[model samples]
Target: MKGVVVGGVSSGVGKTVATLATIRALDEAGYAVQPAKAGPDFIDPSHHEAIAGRPSRTLDLWLEGSEGMARNYARGEGDICVVEGVMGLYDGDGSSTAMVAEALDLPVVLVVDAKAGMESVAATAYGFREYAETIGREVDVAGVIAQRAHGGRHEQGIRDALPDDLDYFGRIPPSSDLEIPDRHLGLEMGAEAALPHEALSAAADHLDTERLVDVAREPPQVDPEPAGARTDATVAVASDAAFCFRYPATIGRLHERSTVQTFSPVAGDPVPECDGVYLPGGYPELHAEALASADTLTELGERAGEGLPVFGECGGLMAMSQSLSTTEGERYAMAGILPADVEMCDRYQALNHVDLEATSETLTARAGESIRGHEFHYSKASVDADARFAFETVRGDGIDGDHDGLLEHESLGTYAHVHAASGAFDRFVDRLR
Candidate 1:
């Protein structure tokens, strides 16, 4: 599992293009390539999956922890793994990409938008490298790939500005066709609108493959075992477009221990015969009306009433509410299990690094146990005082003042999005078993 990280100076810096291009290049070169996105983004992973022919997993230090990251890296069986960074290198709440790099001990390839002069570009790279070092991660600046360089002089300017020790990868010329379409959530994931294979091949042609391969080093190896020899725990994973922020590593972990089944809330799908349900995060507000009228909501509410163990995060939490009102004020009845009303807000409520102290035994979370994760959503819910669960204290930006996980019977719902590597998933499975 050799790894390479593609980071940018800031948002819109072409990390996605670089990541996809690198994955395609490696795959074309006959290397078993695996892709990993840095943050809790669902759309980017979809694109990664389209290119890699496998699901792209997320590695968030805040949510998955150091051990989780190591386990995921070790488990990912690939000749070369590419991990794409979010926003910028040091742009996470408390655990940034630099932190993740340090946790996994992987080298980084900095992608700078060279629309500006050379000296400024060099300064930007210098700042990122210094920041990575300041955080105690001695990240090897494998090389710099310039995007949108003006003429050939932009590369020279960057070369003149950078230190003699830094390596220079190639540059990607500006192209209107290479731009990926975006929507309110992020990039459009429909098959028709996906990035063309030719575009990815062109980007790969521009990148210095030899340099990237040189910097890429394999992760520590772990023994692989035969499947289906594990316990009989069933994990119910949400699988609709509205709530699809799941990581392949999470699913793999569940499958390693027990049988994993998927159910959708959009088709009015019934909850399969399972001991526990794992509802991931996604854009639930977009389909609030359909989810409100779906039979799955009613069935989930009934299960919650029966004390079935259910855990939901982010948009899943919004769907499990009593009712949902969209940003346009379109109201729809929801599960009515939590006695809470969710209203989609015009402002996006994105928060990173949520630390919680569990106050109850729901989902096997012991009282006084603390867990770390992140939250990104646009809907706000108002819970009745009598219906709110007093399980955990949340310390994050989106959480108003102090917040706790909502509990109804054995169900726990909240806006905090957790990684599958977090012990929470395993604990929930074990409790159900």
Candidate 2:
């Protein structure tokens, strides 16, 4: 396997579009292309799956352990693999995409938003490559993709500023057809969401796909012993357009320890008979009415009342509330697992990272244990005194008084989305087993 990791100087620099386009082109060229995202993002990976015809796995060095990162990269059994960087090349709390690249020893293809100042772009690229070096690994700046170039000035400025070692791979001129729609959580995905096939096709046509693929190291083999005998534990995962904020690695990890079952809250499906249930974040607000009226909510409430271990994050947290009030002030009854009334707020709540301390034992977590996760949502949860379970604390700057994560009875909810590879995640899941 050989490939190039595509990263932007910052967000909105067309890295996702360029990455998807590159993957599409490689797939078209008969190369087995596997796509990976750097952080704990679900939407971009969903879009990558749309283009690459494969599920995009996440490789967050902060969330997933170094061994997990290496294992994921090595699992990219393709002629070419494209790893898309999150926020920025070196933008992460403890570890970042640059660290992942270093761990895998892969080359990087920097994507610059050329609409901005071009004269300083070279310095930015140089800084990123240097940052990679300081972390004990040499990084090759294979080339740069100048995005949103207009009037050729941006490209020319970038080319002029580049040092002799770096190459200007290609440019993608601005086009109205290329814009991806966004919401509070991020990009929306469904059968109806726009796929941007033409835009990706055009971007792929301009990049040097052959050269980029030549640098990707081969993926490693994961021959973990078959999962041990199935445990009595079962987790109910919500799977639908509205509730799809789950990492494949999380599910993989869960299955490694016990049997896992999936159910959709949108379709009014019954929660599978299981020891526990997990509702990862998604767009429950968008489908507030349907979910509110769904019979599944009543059933989940019934199950939770029976003391089954239940957990929700972000949208899932919202879904498990007593009521959900949308931005329009429309209210809908929810699972009522927690005595919390969740109301939609005008502003978005996007907590990127936090230090999580377990205040109570709900899932596989023990009291006083600490972990790290990210939280992003817009729902404000107001709970009654009786249902509150204070099991976690945020050590860093967090939303709403720097206290993040929520606990209610046997149910756990939080905006902080932890990756499966995190030690906290391992401990949490171990308790579930």
Candidate 3:
């Protein structure tokens, strides 16, 4: 599919709103739109999926090497793909939006906040376009989308001020309806706080849909790889608001290799009979009360003790711990399978692309194997001194400063959320067998 990157001049530059409006405009124009995110973020893609009615592709170079990243993009289905960028265009160290655009060879439509100046907006867009060259980056800032720009004089001034090279796509007018409410993690999940369709349609009407379609171009084609060997092993994945941070590609990989079943632990469903269990990262802290009393966790603890392989990441790590303490000072008993206590912090405890080398054989990787992933959470774990760990932190913070992957029984939990492209899921499935 042909694609274009919607990049912000900076964080809070309304890139999400602009991208949603662009997706709306494209969909209304009768194109099948595939939404994607340019970083290791789960929240913004929630909004993108809600609007586009499809799972947003996770495109990260750190988590997935260049070939893997391309494969993830290749798996997406649509006539056009709208990749919403992370932070500023060039702000990230591990996997910047500029790098993603350059790798895909896709044109970028810079989202310039036009809440203040007009000519200055064009100047900023020009600078962003030329700055890539200065940094030896081959990013094509093809045009500008005037975020929160007004019509008539304001929009015209932004459009007229643009140099002949930079195209003027359109603007997202300022509106309370255009705002998505956010909390600690990011914006509330799209299901809880989606922008009104009428509001999105109104915003879409102002955009140059034809021009955007013209600007969108195809990336280099990747030869499809043959399907891997399959297994009869069943994998039960936790699915609910509390455990919603799983990547679509992760589930897709599991489904391709084994029988996949899902149950809601937040709703108190008992754990399903399966060869293994996978609890993905999410907001288990928000539902600590419910999870504390969940039969799924109870049975999961029992099964884990009985040698059932279980793997948890981030929030999953918190849920699988001995206890969880909320920011409000309420402590709840957790699954008690892992020898650690988790505490929610007032601010994010750690957020970065992470690399881990297995200090010993674990559920996801073997001894001496390295796993690449990312961590973004608001909680910390107080692990027992005698607790066993599987991996040594090669980069970023883990459960403690030096280690990650708390190991107990046949289960392992970590703060790092790995993508299927990294071969972590493959090892996970193999271990399940």
Candidate 4:
């Protein structure tokens, strides 16, 4: 599909707003838009899906590799795709936005925060474009989207400052209505704090729709992998507001090997009849009382005690713990499947790319195997000192100083969220059989 990567100079540069406005501009131009994210950012893609009306593809080179990223891009359905970058253009290690642009051979549309200066924004975009070549990353910083710039002289001055090499795509006017709220983890989810439709449309009116589409070349072609035939085994996955941080690809992988069943613990839905359980991450802390009052955790505790394999990530790890306390120090009970107490805090405990090596055979990985994922959490767990951990840190901050993967009975829980391409879910699926 034809696409362009919307990158920023750094964090808080309004990449999400620019991307959404770009999507709206493309839609205004009568293009069926498919949105995607450059890194392992599950939250931004939620906004993309909200605007695009389809699940956005996740393209991370570190987690999915070049071939896997291409495959994921190829799976996206639409005439064009708008892939939003993470952090700055070349900020991340292997999973940077520049890497994805180079891997897919797509041009980069840098989002510049132009709320302050005019020529300075152009100069900053010029430096970012040139810096990519010095780093040996073949990324094309094709254009600039002036974020928070007013129409008349403001947008004109920014446009006049750009050189021949760089094109001025458009600007997102500074307005409070376009702002998305934030919490400890990141911006409040897209569905919760979405910008008004008129705001997006007005932003669209400011952007250069033709130039934006012109820079978007078709990504490198890769065939979509065929889905495996469904198996008789049922894999129960948690959904609803609490357990909602799952990647679409992860669920697709599970369905390839088994029947997928979904239930909401926050809604008091009991754990479904299944051979395996998958609890993805979301805002369990905000709904701790409802989750604790549900029969779902009790049933999950019982199933784990009966030797059922249960896997959890982030919020899932919190809900599976012995107890969970909110930021106000109000405590609520959890599944009590693992011997740990989770407590929410004002700041994130872990926020970075994570590499964990399995020290022992676990539900999702063999002993000594490595998994590449990411962890961003506001809660810390107080585990029993004698509790067994299946993984040791290779890169990021884990549950403890250098370890993660709290394992008990047949259940395994960790803060890191892995993609199916990492083979973590593959192992989980294999364990079910």
C-alpha lDDT of residue 337 in model 2: 82
Report the lDDT of model 4 for residue 312: 94
RMSD of 1: 2.7
Per lDDT, what order, best first? Answer: 3, 4, 1, 2
lDDT of 3 by residue, 1-433 (tens): 9999999988999999999999999999999999999999999999999989999999999999888898899999999999999999999889999999999999999999998999999899999999999999999999999999999999999888999999999999999999999999999998889899899999999999999999998999987767868999899999999999989999999999999999998999988889999999889988999988767788888889999988999988988899999999999988889999999999998999999999998888989999999999999999898999999999989988889999999999999999998888888889888
The residue-by-residue lDDT of candidate 2 on 1-433, one tens digit each, is 6667898888778888778777877877788888888877888988888787777878876666677676666655666778898888777766666767766667788988777668777887888777766766566666687777654566677888888888777777677777778887667662446567777777667666666666556444454433434555666778886778888777777777677888888998988988778888888888998897789988998888888777887788888888999999899999988778888887875556567776766564577877777666677777676555544455543334445556655777776777765654455556667
| Cα-based TM-score, every candidate | 0.91, 0.88, 0.99, 0.97
Backbone clashes for every candidate come to 4, 14, 0, 0
Give each prediction's root-mean-square deviation over alpha carbons: 2.7, 3.2, 0.7, 1.3
Better of 1 and 4 by TM-score: 4
Top candidate by TM-score = 3
> How far does residue 44 in candidate 1 sit from its true spot (Å)?
2.2
Model 3's lDDT to the true fold?
Answer: 0.93
Question: In model 1, which residue pairs have backbone atoms overlapping below 3 Å?
Answer: 1-219, 2-217, 2-218, 359-391
Error of 4 at 44 (Å): 1.1
User: What is the overall TM-score of model 4 with all chains considered together?
Assistant: 0.97
Which parts of model 2 are misplaced by more than 4 Å?
A: 115-124, 130-139, 150-162, 190-194, 218-229, 396-405, 423-433
Best by lDDT: 3
- Worst 10-residue stretch by lDDT in candidate 4? 223-232
lDDT of 4: 0.90
